[model samples]
Target: MKIYITSLLALLFSLVLNAQNLEKYEEMPEVDGVYITQNMFELLSKIDVESDDPEEQNFVELIKNLKGIKVLTTTNVEVGSQMKTDVNSYVSSENLSELMRVKKEGKFLKFYSKPGSTDQKVSQLFMFMIDEDTSEKRFVVLSIIGDIDLSEIGQMAGELKGVPGAEELKNIKDEK
Candidate 1:
């Protein structure tokens, strides 16, 4: 009986571990020419909102309620000197621990974050990108944090796919 109980406990532990992993497997959202498909969103989907970390849970709630998402594209290979200047200021001022960050590569900027007390836990990580190329430069992808309505995101995602700037924003997809 003790051995059986131990096995059951081990199984439960594993299940919890897996559940804590990213869950919502939705395609990144792209709005107009804004590129916001950051890999962080994928991981954010896995987090359970009821964790001991209030901050983490708060983020989870936010992601679940994200109304829309955006994506952008650019032709430049590097973050332009002027653009870099602007981004440096923004990234520096924004305070969010980045689980994954890629910037200054082929005119793209991806960001994800959950606003929470660092001492507690990170809740939501919004992922998006910026295209610093052509005449128009902007950070297009943005996922609203906290209790994201999947239906809203879906509806918004579908609409944005057809917009003009939508074509410029690159959509980086994940492989199963």
Candidate 2:
């Protein structure tokens, strides 16, 4: 019984630590971060939308299952380097599989995901991007947790317009 309790507590602690991978960057002056909680998603799902379009309906359904989203961006060279390392570590530690990689318009984007309920769905989507066009290089990390439908990811990107590196989500091709 004692062993069981200890194991359960350890599991909960690791889950929390994994969830807060990007939290440290939130308070840093050099990092721009945005965190949207599960409650916000719940509220968004409750909004009444009288749309007959299948695509629109699918978008709503997608939003309903989302738990949260965390975004961290940095233009400082040092911070950007650190973010790259942290993103790599997070991906490996979380055992996320590489979904895709895109390099276009002076930006390099890499996506990773954790398995979901179905082949077309993902429990978590993680993105890391580096922009080399500007004099000051920019790095971005975006983590989304939920039962996400890969087919509707483009809609998610549209909804999150202006979020750094979100536009690249449209490029994801659900290959197997």
Candidate 3:
């Protein structure tokens, strides 16, 4: 019985990591500012250049690599200053929290929503990244925070690949 239980647990853990294959990623050519891998779509939805905060500054460096960024929201963040307000509003309104961070190491910034909330069991820390060499940005790393629908992020990512820019975002984003 012990052997069976241990094996089952191990199998389950393996299934989790094997969820998304990051290497199989391809940038969407038709969409100017959107790119998708087997799991998530990294996009420069908008650009803000006014803020001096380390996080925002790092975010700018990371996203500069994205080909073309389109703003789905009605936000008018023409410069970095407006982007500062926009990012701050997103963090607060969305209940998004910065958990694990990887800014200088690469172009990926990760944040997660607390688990056990009214939201679905999809507590994934999403990373926003940019390739320094190529200046291409990708939403590439996801770490599990707690128990939830682990596959939710992957499904969302896959959806982004199929749809266009903001239209795809509206369909995949869990606004709640």
Candidate 4:
């Protein structure tokens, strides 16, 4: 009986891990507006720059450690709604902690992260956001994975404010 119980527990644990696997996203068919594993960021980071701004240099240093990124976006009403539901369900089932949530002007942003070697570091950062502008509604799911420095997230956030939902990155920066 004890052996059976142990086996059942192990099976359940494995199932949970599989359910949280982000690799599945990579296999998903790219929707009209959704993108996956784009190299744009890496290419942009490599530009030869002669600027003396410490902030600019700092931004470059932050991206140096980012190994992989995935992003999906949709403007379709049905798809956007479904994506939000799917992401929320996945995040909860995976037990990723909610680092921050911001709502403004009918837009919603949420940030989540999975811990790394130490409490101060994160191996993955995930974001889900819904934006309602005058023209249309946009839903986005973004995941960043690598050896992330918790302290530098704020600087990275500053550089990424132009991107949707990236502004929320500042809230969890420096948190252990």
Candidate 5:
């Protein structure tokens, strides 16, 4: 009984330590974070669209499979550095594979993914980016959890306005 209690305590401790890396930033005053839950996706998926466009239809289907999306952005140099470290650790611990890296218009973006049902699909899409164009450097991390179809990711990105690094998602399809 003592051994069982000890093991349970250790498991709970580890779970807290390994909780979602960027989640902490959500409450920090220096960081701006947006978290969309699975329930939100389900509601979005149910919304009827009058358009007959295949692209719109595909976007709805893609939303149905999405679990959640979390985005964190910061302009504080110190906080940004910490965010970068946390994201690096998260990627390593999660065993996510590097999908691509891009440097454009003074912004550096790195994308990683966990494999899904097929080579073109991913269970999660993670992006870390730094913008060096302005006086204050900006850091952004975006995590999209779902059975994401690479071909339709651009539409989802477009739907999410004001999300840093979202535009970069469109390039993902081009990379494939």
Candidate 6:
């Protein structure tokens, strides 16, 4: 009985580890939107660093330690709703802790993070959103992985303002 229980536990652990692979999300079917990998982030960072603007300079610094970013979005009602369900399940299965949530104007947003080495940082940040209205449905999922400072999240969101669904992030007021 002991050996059987131990074997089962090992299998469960391995399954959980495998389920966390980034490819799983990238390969998700039928949803159409942006999907950015670390290589693309490096290229984008380098390009932004060439700009003379101070804000762009700050973005260069913030993205220096980033490992990867994945964004998925869809506007089709059926596809969008399904993708929302899929993303929520994936996030929950990975055991990421909820960090923030906002609901307004027929839209809902939730943020999650996996802890980093220090209490003030996170290794991964995930955002999920659903926008529902009479005529259209939209959903988005953003996954950012790296040594992310909790205080710098707003800056990161600012950098990503052009991304679909990120415009709402601009409304996040600093509580301090």
Candidate whose lDDT is highest: 5
TM-score of each: 0.30, 0.86, 0.29, 0.69, 0.87, 0.71
Predictions: Cα RMSD each:
17.1, 2.7, 17.8, 4.5, 2.6, 4.0
Clashes of 1: 39
Runs in model 3 lying further than 4 Å from the true structure: 1-85, 117-120, 123-127, 130-133, 136-176
lDDT of candidate 6 over 26-134, digit per residue (tens): 5556555465567866777777345688666766765766888777766766766666666667677778887778888887888888888787778887888887743
Per-residue C-alpha lDDT of model 2 across residues 1-176, encoded as one tens digit per residue: 99999999998898778657656788899988888988998998889889899888888898899998988888999988988877887788789999888898888999999999998889999899999977878998888899998878766676768777667777564443
Per-residue lDDT of candidate 4, residues 102-125 (tens digit): 788888888888888677778888
Using TM-score, give the best candidate's number: 5
User: Where does candidate 4 stray beyond 4 Å?
Assistant: 1-61, 174-176
lDDT of 5 by residue, 1-176 (tens): 99999999997886677565667898999998888999999999889999999988998999899999888889999999999998898888778899899899999999999999888899999999999977889999888899999879976777767667778787687765
- For candidate 4, the TM-score is 0.69
**Model 1 residue 76 lDDT score:** 40
The global Cα lDDT (0 to 1) of model 3 is 0.37
Per-residue accuracy of model 3 over 54-158 as CA lDDT, tens digit each: 655544443332232222111121322333343445445546665444445344343444454345543434333332323433232222333333234334345
The clash numbers for all candidates, in the given order, read 39, 0, 10, 0, 0, 0
By the TM-score metric, which is better: model 4 or model 5?
A: 5
Give the per-residue lDDT digits (tens) of candidate 1, residues 72-95. Answer: 323343433333343344444455
Q: What is the lDDT of residue 33 in candidate 1?
A: 44
What RMSD value applies to candidate 3?
A: 17.8
Off by over 4 Å in 1: 1-64, 77-81, 101-111, 116-144, 147-176
Model 5: colliding residue pairs: none
Predicted candidate 6, C-alpha RMSD: 4.0
